[model samples]
Target chain A: MHPLDEALQMQQQDPGLYTAATHPGYANAVGPFGGITAAQLLQAALLHPQRLGEPISQTVHFAAPVNEGEFVINAQPVRTNRSTQHWLIQASQDGHMVAMATAVFAKRRDTWSGVDATFPHNLPDPQSVAPMQWQKRPEFTNRYDLRYFDGVIPHELSGQERPHGQSSLWVRDEPPRPLDFAALASICDVFFPRIMIRRQRWVMIGTITLTSYFHADSALLTQVGSDYVLGVARAQVYRDGYFDQSAEVWSAKGDLLATTHQMVYFKD
Target chain B: MHPLDEALQMQQQDPGLYTAATHPGYANAVGPFGGITAAQLLQAALLHPQRLGEPISQTVHFAAPVNEGEFVINAQPVRTNRSTQHWLIQASQDGHMVAMATAVFAKRRDTWSGVDATFPHNLPDPQSVAPMQWQKRPEFTNRYDLRYFDGVIPHELSGQERPHGQSSLWVRDEPPRPLDFAALASICDVFFPRIMIRRQRWVMIGTITLTSYFHADSALLTQVGSDYVLGVARAQVYRDGYFDQSAEVWSAKGDLLATTHQMVYFKD
Candidate 1:
């Protein structure tokens, strides 16, 4: 069966509710790079996007180790405001809250103003895309659809491009997952700092706490859209063996649809 | 009076750990940059340069607030090994531990192998030499030598700059004061993220938590030195009027001296 088909089967078994997903790569040890990377848990619960493309945001708090087992995730839309919707998500195992997140979502509409910019100009020309650590072993995990927006591979191994200043990329459910607006909240983790840091090696996960803000006016891509928005992120704190990354993404038209932040393990 | 001379006199007047000279900008609030900047704290704590000069690799948590006032910062080198050194620094206000930092210092050494070439070119070109932040803010807190290694001009009105990526700048006592390690620890706040974010606009203020790490083999510079090492900082989270920042500084030789991570009220 097609991998996308498998995703559909899983969702059919248990729609996009408080579901459980396994850890990916080095994230398995430190508990999903600080428990429930924005990608793994945000879509767990949502009010079901009112429209095909609604804006969303999310946050997660790590309660404990999720270890190698099937944990539970609960996501619910907390408040739907005129401009945005708020969500609260929790990941648990054995009936205990393993991790929790609070997020915001906005409706997608047509408007424009403020910052006008495209992806950073000085970046490596997209002609040099290559497979990276996490993306390299696509056979390992079925949960990730980590693709670059303009075919911009954030790999340091190729020995060419480095995370100069800021970056952006596209990410989606590996088809058939029926991801909702809430999932878009967590899906914010696609092209980020930590992943690009070890562009050459493995995706060094160091995200601990994640908070995301979304704009409802942004159009949603019902069918894993290829349009990627750009955002600015930085590794704010790198202490001991961990580091934190934060960013705000603007739609292709520069509407601040969502802002995402996280803590990732940084051990070389 | 020569800035250095005035600072020396102040040190004599109130001989306490973590004492820094006054700047016009810092004068209005507390030390400098309203409260204090990490650059001043680290620069004042330059007496033991060999111990404090390594670049900060990461910050664990920046727990409390160190406001502007006359106080003492007491720091002790916690653990120093060939690879890392740990320290315990405390900011006491009226005899209470108002701020505390547990830092880990790392040594950025050179070997025939590994990936130094990756980060070198990306390290902000210090020579593109824009007038130091202090230079632009001639009317503001003009008491330090704040060179934005990767500078930002926070809205132009305040002569503050917010670099896109990690902020790297050379900070030193302008009215150069005679400071030790403990005193320098308290001063890290001056260049912190919350303060940096204020450059964007006003938000609500919330409680912030911060942590720091010191590596082994660090060479502290708690005294007046020739060339300065740069302090690198970034913000991890900023939302709900609350945000956290992570940062560290390296000596001119690239030794990881101290690192800091803090969360503070994002008062709008």
Candidate 2:
């Protein structure tokens, strides 16, 4: 199996309870990559026996860093309507809280369609852009292929130009696995901290909370396959040691797949 | 006392539980206004004894319609750090879940500040714009004074122009109440459903999940006491019985106060 798949492996001990171990390949400085953790939490619901349908919206809050070891997940479907469902999930290690999340899933139906937000246009294709090559990066960075159009990490920039904290890039898994909701959720957090772009330097930063809204369904994901998805992210405000990052993920065919927003805690 | 205040009144039943009733003044088609319900969910945390700081991000998922009676809210601060806290809340009537939410709060500190979002400019002041008056609207509509610069409800429009589902307006309490986190949160949902602007007609639409990120502190709220806040909202995509609405609420002083995003279910 691929490393990403191994990283997300879960063993159901009983209903609403599962045990999983952290993969060193996906480990961050403190624990596993937030995206994978988020994906793992999401998987709890997706793998639930009573789950209603595909996830429409999900919010994950990181209370503390996860310790490198086996963690337990308690995911419960609090309510199930005829057409929608609500869930709550938590990750804990040694009986201590690490992260919690809430998710909404719904059965989709045919309806009138429209698109109001403008898609990023006139960008170079993924094949034309060179993938980022970095040394001394987090282990998780090596699990994905990232080709940037702008907003490269501050350490890689060698100039006096100050960016406005915006990045547009094409991203996908390193081994090229098929696209799924879990993969999409993980991809949403691929942007480097916006502070790195604005201040032209790195700082102590961690995502306190992240939310992603899914716009595509199973059919759409199947069409996306193993292709790269374009991701665009920008910071809106950095005040009082907290900043907000908003991002949009688009398929290679120019379809909006998901939109995500996150708030990060930073030390200047 | 104001109806909104009365609607938000919570009686502590225990450490992590409270009881509140739906207010007729803020009634929607079946239940109370979504904004008021969201505010009430947030108040459960703000009123909690263990809450550490102001809310930085919150997500509310509507599992079912809340009935017009007293409902129970179970809010618990699952984890608390030195400067941050995580919360989980559930609102139910007669032991059935109606809504659930999660929130992140942080005690802030001074840091490097920057704003990358552009506030809407060249707009008429609140004093110059006429307030909207409607006779057959939901009761919640009367609780606020709304002056639309554009993107008025389709029922009020009398032209052949097609809108891209966007609205820019000034909004405040009907009797002018002091600004706070709850009021700001309620205002985040003040924009009418984007479907009304996109299809140029009213449809059966309801928000399924709403997430709001607060950027203002108590000091900023105090500075804009009882003043109108500019609210701008737009739809990104409406497809397969669901659409996403993104909004930014700004102080009259051109400061971005909060940004909210929601996914709504609609029938065309």
lDDT values of the candidates? Answer: 0.43, 0.88
Assess every candidate by TM-score: 0.46, 0.97
Clash count, candidate 2: 0
Could you tell me which 10 consecutive residues in candidate 2 chain A have the lowest summed lDDT? A154-163
lDDT of 1 by residue, B20-49 (tens): 444334443322342343333333233334
Candidate 2 lDDT score at position B127: 86
TM-score, predicted candidate 1 vs. hidden true structure: 0.46
Off by over 4 Å in 1: A1-64, A68-113, A116-141, A149-168, A176-185, A192-199, A202-248, A256-268, B1-143, B147-169, B174-217, B220-268
When only the first chain is scored, the TM-scores of the models are 0.59, 0.96
- lDDT by residue (tens digit), candidate 1, A76-162: 554444544445455667776656555444333332112212335443322333323344443323444444534344433564434
Question: What digit string (tens of lDDT, one per residue) describes model 2 on residues A1-268?
Answer: 9887887789999887999888898888778899999889998888888889899888999989898889999999988888888889999999989999988899999987878878887989889988875434898988999998787763465534364889889999998999999999898888888887777776789999999999999899999999999999999888898999999999988789999999999998
The per-residue C-alpha lDDT of model 1 at residue B82 equals 56
Best by TM-score: 2
Interface RMSD over true interface Cα atoms for each candidate: 10.5, 1.1
User: Which lDDT value does model 1 have at B129?
Assistant: 51
Candidate 1 TM-score restricted to chain A: 0.59
